[model samples]
Target: MGSMDRGLRALVGIGLIAWGVTAQNWWGAIGIIPLFTAAIGWCPAYLPFGLSSCKTPK
Candidate 1:
């Protein structure tokens, strides 16, 4: 994944987690997916379609 993609995912993950905490619900647990992916710099969902946000070198 690219830096921008990772950053966005991290932000979204944090937001979801915060929302879950404030609402005191299990739904926030879903945020872990993005957070984990961002940390690992890999997204399984992108593999099948051969998609990537990273820029290719010349």
Candidate 2:
């Protein structure tokens, strides 16, 4: 993933986790999906659709 995508995911994941913690809901754990993908620089959901947020290097 591109830097922008990673940053966005990080922001969203953190928000979800924080919301979950304060709200005492386990659903916040779902944020792990985006966090994981950002950390690994890859998203499984993108694979099936052949979608990539990263720009190709010239």
Best-performing candidate as measured by lDDT:
1
lDDT by residue (tens digit), candidate 1, 1-58: 9999999999999999999999999999999999999999999999999999999999
Residues 5-46 of candidate 2: C-alpha lDDT, one tens digit per residue: 999998898889889999999999998888887888888888
- Scored against the true structure, residue 46 in model 1 reaches a CA lDDT of 100
Clashes of 2: 0
Q: In candidate 1, which residue ranges exceed 4 Å CA deviation?
A: none
Q: Could you tell me every candidate's TM-score relative to the true structure?
A: 0.98, 0.90
Candidate 1: what lDDT? 0.99
Cα RMSD (Å) per model?
Answer: 0.4, 1.0
Model 1 Cα RMSD, 1 decimal: 0.4
